[model samples]
Target: MKPAVDAIVHAFETLDPEHIDTLEALYAPNARFKDPFNDVRGWPAIAAIFRHMDVSLVQSRFVITERIVDGRQCFLTWEFHFSFKRFSVGQPQCILGGSHLVLDEGGRITLHRDYWDAAEELYEKLPLVGSLMRWLKRRANS
Candidate 1:
């Protein structure tokens, strides 16, 4: 289980469009994956989401800073670094998030759910919506 967890972390850190085909090897055939914007089932669908990320974003990478493995489940805290092609061209952005992953006995992820703040991590980084989101956040805090 530990080795599988380590392999997953390594795979995520070096993941790219070229290696997108390898996603099926890391998850079960009917794996369920969900994030802020997508809820998809099956390895094919999961691979599609990653494929979209590779094509849509300027650069995307993940760093797994922490992990806790308990039995067949592992919780990982990661920082996703990326730049949107149309928005922040050369400026790198980061999203602090975590994932809850449940693995089968064979060490293949059966369920993956990512947790992140869409308002702060994504919407607030946009061009027009950024200003509005920031303003609203300031007002709410005040």
Candidate 2:
């Protein structure tokens, strides 16, 4: 399973539009994927999400910081780095998150669920919405 997970990590770290198809080999055909923004089944649907990411952002990559494997389940902590193609921040941004993956007997991922704070990691980084989101967060905290 380490090899499989390693392959997945390598693929994500070096992912690009041209090599997107290679990821299919790492997941089951009907594998399910869920994140803060999306929940979908099947390899094609999962691939679409990556495709959208490539189209919407630049210099995006995932760095897996830690991994815990127990039986057929694995939990990975990662940092997603990217720069918005639409907004020139002049510097990169990063989102801290984790993923819980369940693998089948063949080591193909059966379920891939990502956990992250959308409001903090994504929404609060936006240009116009950043201030509003921060204000709302402060209000909520108060």
Candidate 3:
């Protein structure tokens, strides 16, 4: 059997908010989720994270570049694009990043980790701090 995890991966690749409904069918009642800005438990909380993303982000889209599955875990390499609201010392801008996911026994995600170059993708999108951030990243990488 291909397992429900495959279908879950497909749903994310499609980038449709409605697809989240499929999660209810796939996840355990007490699934846990963790990401850059969120560390939440249960299906409702995880759904809220998606809900927030749907409402707060403008033109947000996720494109899965690769997927690897081992037993109950599925690691997804993805690229995301979204507009961010400018904060006190930042400019409204677009950002990009990758995600990694770990599924549970029922094929529900138990852990979600996001990996991205914050300086290049986020800090560079800032206002006054952008230049300094870019310089620091360049210096650190080189």
Best by lDDT: 1
Model 1: per-residue Cα lDDT over 37-95, one tens digit each: 99999988898898889776967999999999999999999999999888868789999
User: Which candidate achieves the best TM-score against the true structure?
Assistant: 1
The true-structure Cα RMSD of candidate 1 reads 0.8
**Local distance difference test values of all predictions, in order:** 0.93, 0.90, 0.67
Question: What's the CA error at residue 39 for candidate 2, in Å?
Answer: 0.9
Report the Cα lDDT for candidate 2.
Answer: 0.90
lDDT of 2 by residue, 15-120 (tens): 8778899999889889999998899999989999999998889888899999998888899999999999887555699999999999998989999999999999
Order candidates by lDDT, high to low.
Answer: 1, 2, 3
Worst 10 residues of 2 by lDDT: 83-92
Clashes of 2: 0
> Of models 2 and 3, which has the larger lDDT?
2
What lDDT does model 3 reach?
Answer: 0.67
Please provide TM-scores, in order, for all candidate models, with all chains considered together: 0.97, 0.94, 0.72
Local accuracy of candidate 3 as per-residue lDDT tens digits, 1-142? 1466567766776655666666665556777676657778788888888878766565566777777777766677777766654343222354455556666655666666777777677667766788798788789999
